[model samples]
Structure formats: C-alpha cells, structure tokens
Target: MSKHAGVVLPNKFDYGYHAEFQRQCSMCIDDATIEGIVFDFSRVEYLDSAALGMMLMWQRRAAAANKKMMIKGAKGATAQILAMANMQRIFEYI
Candidate 1:
C-alpha cells in the first residue's frame, strides 16, 4: 500500500491481508493530510467474510478520520457479495 495512493487490495482480499490492511488504515488515521482511501477490488477474485469485516473496520476508521472510502471494480460474484453484505448503503461503489 502506498501512503499517497491508498491501498490497492490484492487479488485475494481475504483474512491474510487483514493485519496489513489494519496497519495501513491506522496510518491513514494518523496522517492529517491523507484525504481518502480507495479499496481497489479489480484483481480480487474472491472476497470472503473476513474481507468484509476488514472493510467495515476500515470504514469506521476512515469515518473517524473524516475521510471518504470508495470501492472499485466489484464485478460478478464480488458485486453480489458486497450487495449481500449491505455495504453499498454505507460505501460508494466506483
């Protein structure tokens, strides 16, 4: 994850990435100049429940920091999964 570009999630956005994601978002909260985060799902083939939880965590953290969060490239099953989780209402899909 680049400090200025935000995180471009891995192809498998799963539990394995949780710890790192948390760390990155934590940094975002601390950096006053960081304006927002874009969670890129373009390469993600499978997004499991744990991934959803991670996103939710980031959402809360971003909100606390007064930053916006955007989800991009959610296709096919990935789109359905986010929809099922009702993440659309809380997050904007780009």
Candidate 2:
C-alpha cells in the first residue's frame, strides 16, 4: 500500500499550532505503511520559521522512512516562503 497522506495547513500556522501540526504529521507517518506525505498549503496564508522547521522535520522523517514527501497547492506568500527557504527544491509542489 502506498503510504500517501495529506495535511491541510490551517489558515494560520504559527508557534501555538506547532504541537497540533506535529501530532498530525506524526499520526499520519506512524499509521501509514508507506511513507509518502503531501502537505497541502493551499489554505495557509502565512508561515513562520516554526512552520518551516516542522516541514523540514517531517520531510526528514519521511526520507528516513524511504517515503516520498511533497508539498502541494502552495501559492502567493506561502510559495514565496518555501522558495526563500530553498524548500522548493526539496519538495514537489503542485
């Protein structure tokens, strides 16, 4: 089975929401046999350093598990943020 899962980042992804984000990611990763993760950022208006860090962490975890990690629906400011962080190269954006 392909372990493909997706998470829609809340409109506001900030420090306070870190734990929830982590929990969601972890749950998806742990529950799936395959390691494919797709983080849907279509709804996110702004992302801070913490969000970036969380993304990186999830990416690494997925990589370690030999899973494909991707980012989808990133546009506007969110797209710029990922681009600035050089995460565009690491994630597949759709």
Candidate 3:
C-alpha cells in the first residue's frame, strides 16, 4: 500500500504557476473527504516565495477541512528551502 495521498503537486513550483497549484489544492481541500494530504517533493528541484505562499495556503485549507498534511522526499535545495522557511516545525516531514 502507498502512504501518499491523492492530492498531487507539481515537480516545480514558483510564482508563475501558483494559480494552477492553488487550484489543485483547493480541489482536495474543498472536497473535504480526504484522510490526509501529502506533498511529494522528490522531483521538486526549485521553489520560490510564491511556493511558500502556496504551501501556506494549502496548510490553511487543509486545516479548515480537518485534514492532516505531510511532506516527504524533499532533498538537496528543496530540503534547504523547507528548512529556511522553518516549515519543518509546522509540517510533518517524513
């Protein structure tokens, strides 16, 4: 069995694509029927300020829907970005 959730994010996230990413997250959150949301960062090589905002927005949306959120497979610069944002404290990283 897979631990990953159905909510999927893109391999690369930044300001230019924030709207699309937001839409995907909204679908998961507004559905309000998912057990959890997992952001698989294995392919995410770069992210930006908008990416941070997008994550925060998703976090809020998930909270509103009473869904747990998780992050996994963040490596290299992706890991550093998460650390720099201090997201490790707020999100469950596995």
Give each prediction's root-mean-square deviation over alpha carbons: 3.2, 1.5, 2.4
Where does the lowest 10-residue lDDT sum fall in candidate 1?
A: 1-10
**Compared with the true structure, what per-residue lDDT tens digits does model 1 show for residues 1-94?**
3334367788888999988888887877788877777777888889899999888987897898788888888888888999999989988776
Question: For residues 1-70, what per-residue lDDT tens digits would candidate 2 score against the true structure?
Answer: 5557888888988787888888887887787575677888889998899988888888888787677788
Order of candidates by lDDT, top first? 2, 1, 3
What candidate 1 gets wrong by more than 4 Å, as runs, is 1-4
| TM-score leaderboard ranking | 2, 1, 3
Residue 8 miss distance in model 1 (angstroms): 0.7
**Stretches > 4 Å off in candidate 3:** 1-4
- Model 2: lDDT equals 0.83
**TM-scores for candidates 1 onward, in order:** 0.87, 0.89, 0.84
Error of 1 at 28 (Å): 2.1
- Judge candidate 3 at residue 54 and give its lDDT: 81
Model 2 CA lDDT for position 51: 87
Query: Which of the predicted structures, 1 or 3, would earn the higher lDDT when compared with the native?
Result: 1
Residues 1-94, candidate 3: write the lDDT tens digits.
3333654456777887777777777776666456677887888888888888888888887887787778888899989999999998878887
lDDT, candidates in the order shown: 0.82, 0.83, 0.77
Model 2 residue 24 CA deviation (Å) reads 1.2
